[model samples]
Target chain A: MDYTKQIQEIATRLFAEDKIDVFVGYRLTGFDDNQVPALIRESKDVPLLVFNQKSVFNLSNYLKNDHTRNKRVGLVVKGCDSRSLNLLLTESQVKREKLYVVGIACEGVVDDAGQKMQNCLECMVPAAVVYDELLGEANMERRFIINADIQDMAAKELVQRREYFEEVFENCIRCNACRHSCPLCYCAKCCIDQETATLYNGANTTSSAFHALMTWSLHLAGRCVDCRNCEKACPSHLPLHLFHKWNERVIYENFQEHLAGVHEGDRGAFYKYSMQDPDDFIM
Target chain B: METVTNQLVSIEKPEIVAPPDWQPVIIGILCNWCSYAGSDLTGTSRLQYPPNIRIIRVPCSSRVDTWFLIKSLQTTADGVLVSGCHPGDCHYISGNYFARRRFLVTKKLLNFVGFHENRIQFSWVSAAEGPKFAKVVSKVTEDIKKLGPLHLYKKENFEK
Candidate 1:
């Protein structure tokens, strides 16, 4: 599971071969074993490219930033990050030819608590969906499981469910960390921004959080790769994953078991249609 | 528990029936080419439909952002109905096709979160089928009437 030395080797080779303009990976945060995503521009910095359980941030987000835009990128992706990479390619947010992806067949990463992340626990795609080279063994046999939290939420009464979300919303400080951390939230000017919003303004009201979170979750309904970046970014530690996983579960059930980023070049759920799509709820 | 008692207090019979002259506010986001034109045809043909819905005509059904529907439900509307051209018949080729997928996910997610699914609805009504448009409206109104007020995130006007 320690791919740090291998990542450094590959990054050095890619740099020597002139295969990439930049390498996006992780470096240890100062004073901690935890890693912070590092964008290595020169070959000398390739040694900073490390991959282990603490390599948590999804590097595909940097592809949208100015640092890697239009530059040939050699990047590392865990199971979930690769799916988002597939989506980024599909959405034309990043050109596939420009990316030299080093995929990881993840054995699940741990949180700060050293506990396995819920996303990794239920991960069906333990192998990178798209990559130039792969590390670790692919477990294609892993079955997809609906998150237990979603099942528990579904069993609650309507009022109880509302109350649960109210608590989640009330705790939100309206910091927009979840939105900023989301790789798919690549909009130059997000509608959730108070200055550009037509619905809810920038105020940190509970109602604004309700609107922003609902809008944010809906936008990611078919595209979220369950990277947990949004949840991790939230200072309130809002179960932001619940909003997303709830949407994912509903889309999975209603949209012919459609899972995002599993297949390369797959259009988002809302970008395609099927004859069998459920419409009984339609008038 | 405190919540259990609160729920008991809130569950009084909600006067399910809409009083006479009390029309349910249903916001209808209709695509200009199909559902809106079809609604117009209903007027031209003197065909009657429930007057409860307030139509906001967009260039295409795809233009109806899910947030707009959610906003309507949270603000004033008791129900939201989004109508578009039949699949493959969108004025903007694949607009309704994409809209179909978006609406389906939004509807399912809202329902899963305990918002009554019946409050928001979707349908395909062509411009030629004025009667079909009327039928859809009648059915949507009836369903919303049964559900009564949504009582979601009603906020007072800020600046506008």
Candidate 2:
């Protein structure tokens, strides 16, 4: 997309105006067709800002980190990233006034294989819902599609479902790469860290791996934006989205089609209460 | 005389036997205001339960961070049990409410990454339910034993 030129132009202007202390975006990693997250502090660094099919990382993860905290930041957000930003604002994780968001009317970003991500393919919002300046021609909202894995999981017998998940847990290495890559996983010391988690040693055993991965996923349930960054960053190529999608599906069907971070001030599903929420599942 | 000496030497030698195979370890974090007292009552009544569980007492269920659960799973425990007061009965008025929300979200994530939901247990136990505490521990112990040593993520030390 010619949006790369627009992004660079904006970065230059932000630097010239001295309005932003740092601009977080993406650049080529120089090893392959993959794009890595780039933080531009100088105006001269604007040339490095390139948006292409390989720019896969969700840069909003940096917004919650200490490095960017309290600093006036100019960030580049695709449709999905912008939604996460919205959630951050609602959660009080980040202040809106401190941010100068460059929103993109995204023409869906590509995966490592250069194919459109399933979330993007089923994208309901192709334009940044909350940005200071918007780019690209906004596409119409599409219908939300239930993830294929969740459907297949629902079809399986209980015993078969257990076996299927057993195989998935068997592949985890317990590196915490998924946590590290996630913007919401900003705990100073993670629960999976060995010294702090004395009861659950960080031994990387299969059980340990299983526990670590699952716990990390649970922490992100309602808050996860289905950005697919964790799944993409994972070395074992685990289907991380199924966890988020299943929760998303449940929230969508049960709640008021609640999408995390769609609006600037919307609270999360669990945070808001309704007298009609189903309690049949609870004894 | 030589035969006598050989007999003595053979008699002095100790037999070498293998240690028992590693048993699945499960750590249960029971809130003091509810589940811990329940566990203590189970002990006072001499209720028979599996010895697999090692319980840690916490003031409230909310104090048990997700990191504590993760770390327990990472280290020695095969499964984790987080038992607290039933909703609305929480000693802090709303500690268990926050816990319930946290557990629901955590359970979803653990299942997503392929951990069998069976490995993590969340329940509500009041101080008066001593038998129930024993039952919960016994059930978790039996379930973990059948699952065998948690091997989905290999212990780094076990590697050559």
Candidate 3:
């Protein structure tokens, strides 16, 4: 779980060889145990790059930023971050030849309170799926466990669930942080931000929040890697994973347990269809 | 004269829901080649069906974005019906197949967020199936009616 020296050495080597113009990794926040992602452009700053249990922010998201865009970049990735990176690769958002990836066989990153995040506990792929050089023992055990919160919500009555979600959406401030934080939502002009559309017209109303979040979730339905970037980015700290986990569970059961970006060049479930897809649900 | 006016009004708007007359507005987004043409056939065949549905045509089932469904439910729709070609029958060869995956996920996601599972439904209707189209509409209308009016995420309720 501690690869600080190894990562520093790797970044030093990558920079010394002029292999990458940018190295996206983590650095101490100087405030707490939490680490902030740092984009190191010079080898002199390579000493600042750190990787440990507290490196919670998915660094792959930095690849989509201007610091790494169109630049020869090297970045760190955990199991889930690597999956989202694989999606970004499959969608042709980033050219593979232009980047070098340092993968970590993730032991799960911890939150500010130092507890392992929920997704990592249920993580099936603890090793980087797509990587040049992998660190730590690669364990790709596939564990499928439905989250308890989803089960509890499903058991509630329709009225109860509706009221709960209404309050959740009503509290939304429509900041669009979640969209920017997601690596897969790379469109230059997002549909949710369309001013012409009266529904998601950048309003802070519950109706707009419902539209924006629902549309955003559907866009990431089969592709979401449970990275929790959107949840982490939300200022309100809305439990945004509910939308993603529900879709993930449904896609898994209905589409033969298809996980996003598990295999190279594999598209999301929505992109590829099977004749075996459940048809009884459709009248 | 009063009886004559009343009968005339009823005949002109025969599709109106009876009794309380508060018909649930269902949005029907039909793919151009199959479902839309099938609806056209239903019209030409003069088949009687519920008028609660408001049909919007698209190039194919895959052309219908997930936002379309969400926007409808947010704006004025009580329920949504997305109809495309049958499996292996998409004019675009695999449009409906891809769309089918999205529909199932979107339907379930909306349902998971507390919308009724029946609030959004999907179907496959070919151009030749005029009677089948009517049957599907009536079934969806009836299902939505029984579920009552959709108040979830409506702008009127939450507008500032």
> Which CAPRI quality tier does the interface of model 2 achieve?
incorrect
- Candidate 3, residues B1-160, lDDT tens digits: the string is 0111011110111222444767889999999999999999999999999999999999999998888888888889998999999898899999888888888888778877777777789999999999999999999999888777777788877766
Output the worst ten-in-a-row residue range by lDDT, candidate 2 chain A: A274-283
CA displacement after TM-score superposition, residue B124 of candidate 3 (Å) = 1.6
Per-residue CA lDDT of model 3 for A1-283, tens digit only, reads 7999999999999988999998899999887767999989898998888899988888888877777889998989999999988989988988989888999999888887889899988886879998889998886666656476777777676667777998899888999999999988889898876778877874579888998899899989889999899898999989999999888878877788789987889888888878898898788
- Comparison by lDDT, 1 against 2, better one: 1
| Number of the top TM-score candidate | 3
Cα misplacement distance, residue A19 of candidate 3 (Å)? 1.6
lDDT of 1 by residue, A151-202 (tens): 7777676667767876787788888888889888898888877576755665
Write the candidate numbers in order of decreasing TM-score.
3, 1, 2
Candidate 3 Cα misplacement greater than 4 A, ranges: B1-19
CAPRI grade of model 1: acceptable
Q: Judging by TM-score, tell me the better candidate of 1 and 2.
A: 1
Report how far residue A187 has shifted in candidate 2, in Å.
Answer: 3.1
Individual DockQ of the candidates?
0.31, 0.09, 0.31
Residue lDDT tens for model 2, A114-138: 7887888777667788899988766
Model 1 error, position A279 (Å): 2.0
lDDT of 1 by residue, B59-150 (tens): 99899898998788767899999999987798888897778778877776666555766778899889999999999999999888777766
